[model samples]
Target: MSALVARPFRLLGEGAVRAVRTALMQAVSAWTADWGLAPALVDVDVHRAWDGTSARALAWNHGAQSNGRRAWLAVGPDVATGLQQMMFPADPSYGPVGSATPALAAAGALQALDALLDALLRTSLSSQHNVPRCGAAVPATSWEYGSGALVARLAFGSRHFHVLLDGPAVQALVPPAAPLPALRAVDVAAGVADVPVSLRLQAGTARVGVGALLSLAPGDVIRLDKQADAPLTLASMSSHPLFHAYLGRCRDEVAVELVQSHTPVGEVQ
Candidate 1:
């Protein structure tokens, strides 16, 4: 009875999904143009399933072989049969598994894919999945095959960079980020002769328990844990450190400028 039920929506959705996959496959070919791979050698193919899953293949560089042939390129769902997949698979099987044809060398195709992945990972459409000892599974959104298991498996491909599996996965690849500016303090001065004792700078007061507060009496000193030599900190509304300067007077006027900062002004340390 269940098998006889209508499943039109599922079928329609799967068809739409495959159409989108085909479009993305074309985009992959255009995207890899920077890799300078021969377009003639590359052939993008699409495989769709009754289930919502789909796979796209691009032959980056392929050629005839003694027995079989294969295609290679930047994007594919079947990492096993896909050139890049064969080279770096989550469940790596080095030899052969499926059909053969004029295929690209899995190793060389991977090198190109590696560069592209590095870029894709920087973007939002990419994800990395650790497939145990079989290396990493770096599948870009263009390589998406409509599986929650596949998406959940994304992990960081390279050791460096903020590239990750589930974070911002934008499709367009952006350049690597630059290093943050270092912190620097402005002019600072400590005690000097004849400075007004009552003019001593004060840090923000902290609240204590009711019992502790009531215990305080006139002439009773409560020494704070803050070090006396600690630079006076000025913070912006954003909680970012703006500057650090010692309390001092320059001809009856306090002044501060570039000296050294625990962190750069206007910059988060």
Candidate 2:
């Protein structure tokens, strides 16, 4: 019951499956056009089927990684046979296949799958919304192809195949998403204009026995771990080191001249 209830949510993209499916199908169609092989995507979903497992597959790390990705392809006995018949130069029945079944006859099937996946990825990148697509633009070089690891089980027509993409390969396919309803600009000066902070003048240090410290009088001085004339560290109320300053006197009052900031310039106070 739990698995049944969770499957849909796991597969569906916040009720955006239709849109995602359509986009993926379009991308696949554009690529299969070269071979006149329309291997449509019958069903697609994101899953953790091969999250950390490695298997015999044509998989390789692709581009820089920023997120997770999984790609599955399934080609059943019949579909595998059909694909082989159409794509391979020599018939499956000829040469070494001899008496093997269609599923077993998918000779050079890995190469075929590699080409299909590569094409789909390129087309997918090209189909990005408003992303420039022209002769000057190159289809993304983000796909890392190799053999090992089962990432997905593709279901298209009557065929079933297991395809996988490593973490890096997935990164190539999906770009980092930008925040939606982008943050609006606002004046920040007023919010932090007047804030109280802890300004300390850390002099020097001296370690003494408890007995020696207790024996001290009002005229005694306990040194700290700092040095004379050393820079002072100003800390915020939150205990965050804020800045380094130099002890000085401004006009007639003692003050500290800010010497260096502890954080980046644009960081909020």
Candidate 3:
């Protein structure tokens, strides 16, 4: 005895769904005039399986290198009858020959359906190596149900129908993810190493009234905000402090010895 294992149903991603929907809508809109039928896309979705009991379907295969991928376009009884009536209106003068309406409508609709399949395949296989082509119509009963498939609902002159793409067909439309570039260590100091930057040193500051400042004469002492023992701030031209330094003498000339690095509040070192 052989054991049967059930596989989990995989739903189509958002990107794949959008792509199929857009392709179908575009194809219908483009060929509406030539098709002689006004078509509109109602909905596009994913379904586990298609119920073929009460629906008539046209099956086709397409692939880049081989015609192994399969898809189906199906319509309910009402849609089929509507298509028959639309393709062959009642001609009372031609009495018995009117019985052939169903067959004639099916044959005529095949061309339009094939065109839709071509449009979908062209869009999905654009990035692939070989251009995809649709094979001749196959028997709908021959189509094997997969774990899940994409189903598109379309309305043509009040008649609604469905287009289904099998798992392999849906996968063909999904674009491959691009590879990320390799990461490398960056030289933190190389780019700015040669750039010139101007720095300033601030010894102390004081706030005085305009009158008092104007009245100040030579030899008059002005008190500063900083303590005498405090180190001065070494900053950039923009007045951003970079370091703390103490005023000192180097070889009898005035100099500043860096005591510590200065970091502004709320700033990382």
**Which candidate leads in lDDT?**
3
TM-score of 2: 0.31
- Candidate 2 residues lying further than 4 Å off, grouped into runs, are 1-27, 37-43, 49-79, 82-150, 179-269
lDDT of 3 by residue, 135-180 (tens): 4453443334544456666665577766656566666666666899
lDDT rank order:
3, 2, 1
Better of 1 and 2 by lDDT: 2
For residues 1-269, write the lDDT of model 1, one tens digit per residue.
46664311222233433433344344445545765544433333333222243222223221111111111223333432353443444544454557763255565655655554443332224223311112233334323333211111111222111112211221112234468998786533333434432212345466578998899899977766566666676555556555676555578787543245657444433
Range of the 10 consecutive residues with the lowest summed lDDT in candidate 1: 62-71
Off by over 4 Å in 1: 1-9, 13-18, 51-109, 116-269
Local distance difference test scores for all models? 0.37, 0.48, 0.60
- The residue-by-residue lDDT of candidate 2 on 202-265, one tens digit each, is 4445789999977999887787777767897877666577789887889999888888999899
RMSD of 2: 15.3
- After best superposition, candidate 2 residue 221: deviation in angstroms? 42
